[model samples]
Target: MTAQHPSDVDLFAPPRRSGPRPTTTGREIPHDQLDQFSPPRIRAALIGHATALPGVFTGPSQVSEPASLALRLHDPRGRWEAFLYPSPDEFGHIHRTGFMHLTVPRPIIAPLIEAGWIEPHPITLRPQWPDTIVMLYAPRDEDELALATAIMDASWQQATES
Candidate 1:
């Protein structure tokens, strides 16, 4: 986690999301971001806002599969708390869905999960990795987009806790 994440991520902005959670698969290397993914236009809007944040940069993903562009920050509030794989390539990556992966604080992880916004990353299941890595569901509509961006902001702040 060399720092860098983005968007207006307010991890605790609203009450728990309602309804059933999106169908998410892939627990191993290529964690799937399936079901209710954002369209290109929505994804673009998310990318635009995320990249616009200070200290965040867009580049090839160090962790994800091919053709995945990720957002990372310049530093961190703590250890390995930066970097977000927001979307994946349609042709080259397993996760065609546009959901993102990043590490957030432990305190917020439970709330996020309880709220139905995220799932624990498989990496977190291992002893070496802390329970911070999570897969945020992709936004399918305007409301979801706003919440997603807010979560992004929170991730960004955690990474760049100056």
Candidate 2:
């Protein structure tokens, strides 16, 4: 066998043109354009329903608990249970260079406190995703529901924009 020089080896080559290109534009046709990108619509069904009070705004989407952590909201009288399902972006935030913390507007939180939806509970770490919060509310506490709705709506809105 003959010894081969390292520089003689072809370590890298241009990517092979495997698929057909447009005759006119010379651009590859995206597969999604032909098939129409569609997936089964799966929705989160609310197991325990909570209502926001009148005059509170409701945007689309339900607030579900993140799988990593369970939230139990407490008041002077008792405790309320909630589950959490965090979004992918939340994971992205926690993995960043520094610890990221999200502050819920006081305007939103104060009303829920006064209405007995939540108390002065310690801010729960958002599981593996540090950008979210969770809660369980009593019936017709509109403010809390609206806040939850707003969060979900904002997430969906951001998702669509990109």
lDDT of 2 by residue, 95-126 (tens): 01111112223344445334433222223432
* Reference-based lDDT, each prediction: 0.64, 0.23
Q: What is the number of backbone collisions in each predicted candidate, taken in the order shown?
A: 9, 9
- Evaluate residue 77 in candidate 1 and report its C-alpha lDDT on the 0 to 100 scale: 42
Error of 1 at 29 (Å): 1.9
TM-score of 2: 0.24
Clashing pairs in 1: 3-73, 4-72, 4-73, 8-150, 9-150, 9-151, 9-153, 9-154, 10-150
Q: Would you list the clashing residue pairs of candidate 2?
A: 52-141, 52-142, 53-141, 53-142, 65-83, 65-84, 65-85, 66-84, 66-85
The weakest ten consecutive residues by lDDT in model 1 span 86-95
| Model 1 error, position 46 (Å) | 1.0
Q: Where does model 2 exceed 4 Å of error?
A: 1-43, 46-88, 91-103, 123-147, 151-162
The TM-score values for the models, in the order shown, are 0.78, 0.24
